[model samples]
Target: MVVYEGSEEQTNRIFRALADPTRRDIVRRTVSGEASVSELAAAYDMSFAAVQKHVAVLEAAGLVAKEQRGRERIVRGRPEVLRHVHAVLDELELLWRTRMQQLDDLFAQEAEADAATRPHDGTPPPPVP
Candidate 1:
């Protein structure tokens, strides 16, 4: 299954944007509801312009969107992009699970081979402890 359906550049941008703690918080806030630039700025200790830059980064990554509402730029989270992120994570999890299963199968095969090679004299193996 193709996890990252988006372009490589887009995936990089999304990850880069999400790397920032403030931007992640912004995304979290916007996902619940839309907020104006000023409103978002007020929630943080940073300057308004700094918050604006974070929003811009998120917008560029397609994680969040901004629309002009009168003089204010209202920001809202893009759930579709987040869904893509989740899909990628799910794919990774599946890959790890498969790898673990393969390792288990290999260990089981090794154990079986070892048992088969053991002498049939009925002498039990030593205690593991």
Candidate 2:
């Protein structure tokens, strides 16, 4: 469970969590609406223990929360955790956009340099004939 100290490891954990299919499914299910352990487990072919482990990983990441009620555990996804993932992605997108713009500017500069270095005769550099 990361405490949001803003360390790189914690940042990577969010990415790692988003990488797993089962975890993503669990998040999608819970985010749309809450469900119980049995309900969630039944949706998958894997054993209950396997599903429980997935749920545990999600809970540890603070992506989901579990509550006990009469021996049934109800699970719900936390949107804020998903929002954190979105924020990281958004930041990365901004960085890439900035980098791409810089590359484009460099390309334009190179074109200008080529034009300046070329002769203005509007003719070939002299054919072999």
Candidate 3:
């Protein structure tokens, strides 16, 4: 099987980080533009420490990065990580589509073989109730 750029562990971390609603929102917000840690904390009802934890998870997953500017820590989204995610999904879709086409071809072949084996009498088979 063809694997995407990241290792399995890294992919797992990325998915885990995105599993939380708060973390997902943080990513969406930061992707549009960078935000200060305090700003992100203020958006949520939770404590600043809770928001910090969310940012830590995102940073660990490589989905977001943090930079220090004076006394504030700025968080920015990494669009390239999202692109990697999309690439993996696209590959899986292609694999699934290929499998579905193979199944269709197999069923068609079976039907054709069944028809060939059937009698060529003028009368057709009774309808299935």
TM-scores, one per candidate: 0.84, 0.87, 0.82
- Which lDDT value does model 3 have at 37? 100
Summarize candidate 3's per-residue lDDT along 1-129 as a digit string, tens digits.
436677899998998998999999999999999999999999999999999999999999999999999999999999999988778788889999999999999999999997886778966765669
lDDT of 1 by residue, 1-129 (tens): 545667989988998999999999999999999999999999999999999999999999999999999999999999999999888778889999999999999999999998997778998866669
Q: What is the C-alpha lDDT of each candidate?
A: 0.93, 0.86, 0.93
What's the lDDT for residue 73 in model 1?
97
Q: Name the candidate, 2 or 3, with the larger TM-score value.
A: 2
Best by lDDT: 1
Query: Which has the greatest TM-score?
Result: 2
lDDT of 2: 0.86
- Cα displacement (Å) at residue 6, model 1: 3.3
TM-score of 2: 0.87
Report lDDT (Cα) of residue 22, candidate 1: 98
CA RMSD of each candidate after superposition: 3.3, 3.7, 2.9
